[model samples]
Target chain A: MKLNKTSRNFKILDAFYIAMMILPIIFGIVLQVLTKPVSEGIAITGARVYFTIPMPVQDFPITESQVNSAIVMVVIFFFCLYITHGMSKKIELKRQHLAEMIVEKVDSLVKENMGEYFMGFAPFIIAIMALSAFSSLLTLFGLYPPTSDINIVGGWAVLVFFLITYYKMKCGPINYLKGFAEPVALLAPINFISEFATPVSMAFRHYGNVLSGSVISVLLGSALAGLSSMVLGNLPGFLADVPLFQMGIPAVLSIYFDVFSGCLQAFIFAMLTMMYVGGAFDLETYKQKKARKSAKNKQ
Target chain B: MELAIGIILGCCALGTGIAMIAGVGPGIGEGNAVASACEAIARQPESKSSVTTTMLMGCAIAETTGLYALVIAILLIFVAPGLLVDLLVNTMNGLK
Candidate 1:
């Protein structure tokens, strides 16, 4: 019957959303009318080097991924700072509620997945999750997503791998080594190599999903541009360069790829990290094994 | 010699196509996983969240093989053809 402030704000957001969808197509048509048709080759190239510093062994080259990642991290830093600034003992403000919500969500996620003993890892997991989700979501702003770079995802996977190995080694060095030869000595080499597969698989899984999404987007965009040019060849310059299809479709695909998959991958990465690291310290199984060993020692 | 280069390029394309056959394993495996997940969720509606989470995780893990094949195909299509062509050209020039 009556409009509230929050509902009014939502109505404004709906208008903005509709404008975003329509403005692009209108702008594309206008741009086509103005500029010459330029059909660029579509290739899925890696991060570009912005500049290089000369070195004797190997020149240090700064890349798109590096600069964008640094920017993303800085943005995240200021965001956290802004949210937590002017703190009070009681949560009196919306920003305080937001800050508490973020921390509480991440805390509950880590506690549920990794158990209370690994509460120390909550901050680390939150850092990984935030950096990953933010980096993947960077693509919507027209930046080269860091997650598409294998090196970025690989570095995170390697760090998680280190944590996994660290937890495994807590059982004892001899026991850890002996784990590689479990069931039969002949399987030791395979078991040893398979352990390393964890990080490699994790890296490739995240990188491939992110990269594939961008690759498909690029391919679709260029294909639409070409198709538009071909079909509208008989028409004047405006119609020929319209890029009609891309304006209609890419917005939808980007929502699925950038928002859905980006968040999904980030959650999956964090979940896998928790599962692998937590599986290492199966307190019930470890306790039972220890008890059995102590009984044997007593006998 | 030109024909040989064409054949090499063609074969690379074929190999890339063949590499995608790796997708079959994961597709079937993930389908079965989702099917079972749906059954589990239907049997116990309250377990839907946990079941969905587990199914998605399994699907993602299962997807790695297909993703590896896709990566190899990309390399074959983009990298191998150019590298092989360039090497052949240089080798022919040296022979000349």
Candidate 2:
């Protein structure tokens, strides 16, 4: 088939759109450094508690700083989603044919095969991809990965839980809540607690891993540089005396610190989030119901 | 010499801290996966198992980059040849 001018133009436009999206991120880094100059260290300096509820029982005091993390996480999620939503909408309007084509393809594969629930899931998937790209890019430049922050993760968990609860309620609150009691009401609280715990754990797991990885990166780099120097000084010969070799030696480790762990942690965080959300909806019940219908048909 | 060594080590630590800034990718990517996956399960309410599997697979793939960084950092710290050379050199110097 002959290549159409329109098709070629559309390709060019797509490239431009991607560049536009990335422009701000790049600019922000430059501006951020020139003006505010935020230090690129993975350290939690302080905490800001969000709310304080009076408790009759004595316990650790609740401070606004405590919930600050949750708030930050929520904000990051909101910010990422907001950007992705805006971009998708703009793309849809600007390149309707391409957008429709993409949507249709996804719908057939996701909604048709996975079920109708996967219909609107594309937006979220795109959003996650964008955020992952942004997070990974930021890590390369030595900035705090917002996703690695507990507050951000907690915020995400909270958002996920709220969405799940909202859907469950919309479907039928009474029936939905009853689902938790399934096979036993005594198990309801356990189920209920698990649902809420999903986000908390999801958020923390990412935060803990990324944060720990960062610390390790710092410790490793330092130890290597130190070792290289001490070795070169004592040897005092061409075999041992080379500063270029010293720094070059550690660059291998740098690749790992900068590339692999950064992306892996992001993927893990996203996977866990997907798994938790999937569990909240439950798959076993549907299978059992389907099996019952099939058995009855056979009889 | 000790002061220089201290400063150099400090700078390396600083460089490491700088390197880790790239970690933001996996965190947000994973979080978005979780949120979207939850939304999918919410609507379909049927293909939960299949959906979960796909999501886990996707997340694992995303995590590959981050894991590379982690491994490199670990090698640098715990199993670096350069570090072993340094340790040996320092010990030999001390004996003299």
Candidate 3:
């Protein structure tokens, strides 16, 4: 009749997981309520004219509500951190005795299976995974997901790009750059552009898709509301009916927009990051050697 | 003016909701992957570690799609273009 100790622990973990998921929703609601009414406006203070002159745009400014919405967004961002911390903790607990589950998983996989070349890649995977999850969840509760912000994603791209380049230079700068000279030096500029394009595309692709989806969703909701009011004479058929109608529609879209697409973009970003770092470190040499061996066998 | 404001506000709300559509692909793919992995593990319990590793990797890849959608949604809500007559006037006057 006695439950196993592990079973009890799992029950506790399940409870914790539920709480972690709910916390963001609760915080988002509270924050949204507290910071309602914030919106865009012209600035009276420190307004710049061209590059040199200063001019006040407006003396009276937007109400405190406008700023509150932005503040609410900031609060939601911090809430995301909590969700990430909880997930990491849960992962750590699941991999009992391993102080760092993600690190151990990647290290053993790469060292024993993939190769020592991927030794330092585990931490990056875990960090990106956690960050993506946090950012995505914020979107669920009507907050500006931080990753969508160019400044934020761009910073991540630049940081990883530079680090990869640095590692490549340290590993073998000549060999690293030589990869760009493939086929002919005439193709070097194309190679360089392609290399740089990875980060640029990664940042904008994510921003563009998510931003467009939001716009589309808002347009649909309003259109539905308008149709309901006209047809039902404000009897609120939309309250009772439109949700059910849109459910089938938006539910399908959410599958791609929210779940599948988001995860793939995160993975692509991380995978491209690994490839960039590997190139910098001349790991392509190992790949080339492998290809050469297969070619020789065929010959 | 009311109609215009309504349009703007409605767009904002609907935009946020629709932005969530980007999540569909990752959800189905990741779900299928995890399901297949679970089935595989059930069939051959010995391959649990390998299966789990692959599952996680697939899940991670699936997650990026949702993240991209989130990015776009956030931008729509926070930085969406709107017509501000006063700002438009300032901008036109070369005083912005």
Candidate 4:
């Protein structure tokens, strides 16, 4: 192939290569000098407490997760506002189209998964999905994501557990009680314990995935810092301390752990909620009971 | 006394390592699930999306056991040893 030696594209490519070599070293040294690592060493820790409130009976400590959750809630509040701001019979803007698409998709997903009669559960399911997916993505902003906190995810899991129980009981109180002794009377205790295990497992799964991701990120970051100093230790004053190796390398791992895993866990949590709650009741029995109650009112 | 404390920490480190062995089962299980999904997709490319989504849900369920193991290991690493050592020291001082 013939080369275009003097073209504008060629010149630009040449300049990019030249800058790529010289820029990182100069910038890395400057950045290193100007800043320090957020935390000194690598160890897994709980959310830091910001303050304590002296209540009547005990002290209420406000944590990083609490603050971050408030921020996330404000963000979601504004997002809902923006999505609902324009009211028109026709969809003209891309924003309106996108909002309409999201609602329609969520509605269909619920109807498909939970069947037609449970259409009213759409808003609850959507709220859970939005809160989970958005809070999980908070890690990208360097915020302490609330979903990573066991208490936060545990609360949501408990809500799901309650919904599951409510739907199960709606069919028949007797069958709901009998579900504990499923298959045999001897296994009642085991079955009862398993009922409680569902929510605990759900909570832990989301929290563990996020926690492990952050732990790995911190360990990788500290290791890179150590490795960079070892290799570049011989550099002139102020350059030895620079994290020369951590510039672009960790982004590869971040994309998977923070973005991909975060979103996947959120989706998995929502799917499990829909499956468990939707399948809890016998649809025929539930409908029959509702019909009987309504027919009595007509009489 | 120092030896006992040292041994507690050492054993916790070992326990954490062993707890992570639970990760092995899920890895193998998910691999098998994905392999089967791939074969199914190759046979019928038109059903790729459904196949992948089903596979993902199955994999996440399979991952529950490993996630439980991770939580257990973290507790062992970060919470158990320190609390155990503190209890030991307190009892020793009380005996004095």
Clashes of each: 0, 40, 58, 0
Q: Which lDDT tens digits does candidate 3 get at residues A1-299?
A: 12443476756765665566566556656755665555453211111111223348745443322332344345444534433433342344433433455457656644553357667667666566556545644556655555545555677787777876677565355776787898899999999997786676667655555544555655665566556556556455355444334445665766666666556566656655665665556557656866888999999
Clash pairs (backbone) in predicted model 4: none
The alpha-carbon deviation from the true structure for residue A111 of candidate 4, after best TM-score superposition, in angstroms, is 1.0
Clashing pairs in 1: none
User: What lDDT would each prediction earn against the true structure?
Assistant: 0.83, 0.56, 0.59, 0.83
Candidate number with greatest DockQ? 1
DockQ of each two-chain model: 0.76, 0.08, 0.13, 0.70
Q: After superposition, how far is residue A194 of candidate 4 from its true place, in Å?
A: 1.3
Report the lDDT tens digits of candidate 4 across residue range A128-241: 888887887877766667888999999999999999999998878898998888799999999989899999999998998998898899889889988998999999999998
Cα lDDT of model 1 by residue, B2-87, tens digit = 89799989999999999989989999999999999999999999999989989999999999999999889888987899999999
Task: Tell me the TM-score of chain B in each candidate.
Answer: 0.96, 0.72, 0.73, 0.97
Interface RMSD of 1: 0.6
lDDT of 2 by residue, B1-96 (tens): 456556546555555555555567877888899889999999998989778867876666555456455534444443454464577568768999
Q: Candidate 2: lDDT over CA atoms?
A: 0.56
- Model 2: how far residue B69 lies from native, Å: 20
DockQ of 3: 0.13
lDDT of 2 at A187: 90
Better of 2 and 3 by TM-score: 3
User: Mind giving the per-residue lDDT tens digits that candidate 2 earns over A1-299?
Assistant: 12342467755755665555555455545644554426663333322332356677854544422332233334345443333332443344334554466556645544443355545665664455445435544655544555555565567668767866765554345668787897798998888887776666555555555656566566666666566667776775685645544466455765675466556555555445444444445445656766888999999
lDDT of 3 by residue, B16-92 (tens): 78988978888898889989999999999999977886677666556666766676666556556354434444565
Model 4, span B42-93: residue lDDT tens:
9999999889878988998898999999999989999999899999999999
* Candidate 4 Cα outliers beyond 4 Å, as residue runs: A1-39, A56-58, A291-299
lDDT of 1 by residue, A1-299 (tens): 22342366755754555555445434433533444235467667788776799999999988767766776676666667656754578554477888888889888888888898898988888888888998898887676788999888999999989998988887778778887888899999998898999999999999988988998898888888788778877797577667767676888999999999998999899999999999877577567878989999999
